[model samples]
Every structure is written in C-alpha cells, then in structure tokens.
Target: MLTLQRRQLVGHDILLARHGNHISTMRVDRQAGRVVAYLDDGSVDSAPNLITPGLPMPATVRSVLREDWKFFAVATACTTGFAGVMVAAAVALAGLSGEPGMTQLLSAYSGT
Candidate 1:
C-alpha cells in the first residue's frame, strides 16, 4: 500500500485509479465508513468497503474438524468400551444368556 501526501486527500468518495481512467476497486477506511485509496492527484483514500472472499469450506471446516476430531474419537471409543463392558458384565455377573438382550434395559433407562 502506497501512502500519498496527506495534502492530496479528499472527501469520502475520493477516486482511485487501479489501471486506467475507470476506478477498478475501492478500499474502505478502518476508522470510519469512508474509503482509502488514491485520487487523480494521488492521495490516501479510505471507505467502509467489505470484501468477501467467499466461504472456504475445506479451509475453515478443516480447522474445526482438526480441533474436534480427537474428542470425537475419544467419545466414540468410550462409548464402544462402555457397551462392551455392559455386555460382558451382564453375561458374566448376571449369568445372562439368550441373545443377552438390552431392549428392556435400554427402554427403561431411555425414559428415565
């Protein structure tokens, strides 16, 4: 970013020539809702411009997934271990057999 002379600054709608006569793009001012750029005489311009690069799904989601993947794996592992332990305990301690069903237990606990 080139900083032109402050004397050359103008109003909020100060024009900036990116290439030729036409104003290609305008940069917004940070402090106010004005613009920042160069005018015909050359100066710093500013405005309240918002540029959206669009949603980067993979880039953004990757960070969130990376941060949560460990917890997800741990949760899944714990759930699997809990289910295994429950089945084992039922079979061994309770001497339960015949499909070792959990429908009744699951249904009763689900309500509670």
Candidate 2:
C-alpha cells in the first residue's frame, strides 16, 4: 500500500510514486489547481477532476506506497538538474542569437 502526503500548488507540479516495481499500478499527481502529472515516459496524465475543471474532484490516488512516494524525491532532484541545463542553454542561445529563432533545429547526425 502507498501513502502520500497531500500537496498544494498554485501551478504545475508533478509527483511520481516511490515504487516503480509495479508497472500496472501507475503513480500520479493529484491535480487541484493547474497541476498535472508526467509518467516515466514523459507523457502527461491528469486527475480526471482536473480535466473536468468544474466537477467535484475524484480521489485519484487511493493509497501511496510510503516506499514508492520516497522515490519521487529522487525524480524531483533529476528534474532540477535538467532544468539547470535548460536554463544555461537558453541563456547561451540568447547571448549568441540575441533572440529566439523560430526555426526548428534539424538533427546533425543520422542513424547508420
């Protein structure tokens, strides 16, 4: 069984389960305001209540595996590191280009 501490956020916040051993049981972030969840594959999954927008919120997470919930702390750390890299890239691009280009970047390397 899982146990999660309820969270409150004004904007987007993602939380994954500490336990990822079971692929069948999906971990999720219970959306209250503008929050949404991202799976391991980087796909989004929101609580049905969030999708409805005005309807009563259903309990998305029945139980939080105390063990599984802890793993989320690690995910959050990784996200932080990635965000730092993104910020540095954005800054470098701005410095070099003076503006964000509208063009999409094509891959430089092709598969064999």
Candidate 3:
C-alpha cells in the first residue's frame, strides 16, 4: 500500500511507497488513476495503481477538448450562429437604409 501525503503549498499530493527497502515519492492522480513515480535512476515512469487499493482509475484525457468534445462542438456552433445572426442583422439594416453613392471615391478614381 502507498502512503499518501498532501503538500497543499505546492498544490501536489505526494504518494510514498516502499518497493523493497528504499521508499519512493510519487504523485498519485486519483482522477486520472495514474501514479507517476520519480525513480532513483532519475527517470519518471507511470507506475501501476495496483499498489494503491480502493482507488478506481478512470480514463485519462490528454487535452481539455478531448474530454468533453460534444460540449465544445455545441458551444462553437452556438457562437458561430450568434455571429452570423449579428452579421445578417447588420446587412439587413444597411439594405433597408438604401445604398449611399461614393461620390468622393468615384471622383478621385475618375480624376474629375
């Protein structure tokens, strides 16, 4: 079994466990169900959570969007729809006011 310790100041929960004689400090993410141990060899490895019982490991998401993709897609569609509506309203308002002739532009281009 792994002994759990919380370092609130560092915002990381450290997990300590003994393999044979040497005790290792590791980080246990209960949400992702992942245990990252800093080995004495200076190599980091994702250790198995089997050492920590009563902890159910869930699927880990690599990115934020990968977790809730459906919600993200809906939010994007809603924002795009709102922007399209605003643009449509502006175009309608402009059309209703009628077109303004560009007299200065026409004169400048025609060299009049």
Candidate 4:
C-alpha cells in the first residue's frame, strides 16, 4: 500500500510518500501550483496536480460471486437449518403436551 503524508519543515510543506520499506519526499510548491517529487537517484520530478482522475471500472456479477457467494450460501443454509431444528423441536414439545399444548400451559398459569 502507498501512503502520502505532509509535514511542515522550516516554513515549507514537505510530502512523504511511503511504500513498504521505501520512503521518498516531495515538496509542495503552492506558489507554482505544482508538486515536486524527489527521486532516489537525486533527480527531481514535477507534476501539475497531485492526483489524476480516471475512468471507473465496471462491476461484474462474476467478480461479486467470486468474492462472497460461498460465505452467503453457507450463512443462508445454516440459518435455514437452525430454524428447521427449532420448529421441529417446538412441534415435538407441543405434541408431547397433548391437544391444548401452549394454550393449556397458559391457562394453567393464569389459574382459569
């Protein structure tokens, strides 16, 4: 990853560009409206602007599936399986409690 940082040094704003173990410095010339990059070989390079705008990349369904389909599928399957187990358990318990089931339990608790 590339990271850019700015600091004030001796009344001048200096930009530091870091990538991995390599570090380089750049000087921001506000008066000239240009950014100067100092190279490792002691050569200076200048750019009109810091960042250039480019066209956006198109999103594809294959890319989306490649990135997250497995996770989504597993999550959905697990949720459905859990719900099925809970429903089956509730039905079994209701059957064991006889015809009234939860209604009978509630009436007994209410003393009516």
Which digits, one per residue and each the tens of the lDDT, describe model 1 over residues 1-112?
3232322223333344333454445565646635656545565445433333352223344565687899989999999999999877755644443343553453334445
Candidate 3 lDDT over residue span 1-112, tens digit each: 4333332311122334334323355677667656776667676656445545574434444344476899989999999999899767666665565445543322233336
Worst 10 residues of 1 by lDDT: 1-10
TM-score, one value per model? 0.31, 0.30, 0.39, 0.35
Q: What local lDDT score does residue 52 receive in model 2, on the 0 to 100 scale?
A: 48
Error of 1 at 73 (Å): 0.7
- Model 3: lDDT to the true structure: 0.54
Ranking by TM-score: 3, 4, 1, 2
Highest lDDT against the true fold, candidate: 4
Candidate number that wins on TM-score, 1 or 2: 1
Clashes of 1: 11
Location of the lowest summed lDDT over 10 successive residues in candidate 4: 11-20
What CA root-mean-square deviation does each model show from the true structure? 14.0, 20.0, 10.6, 14.1
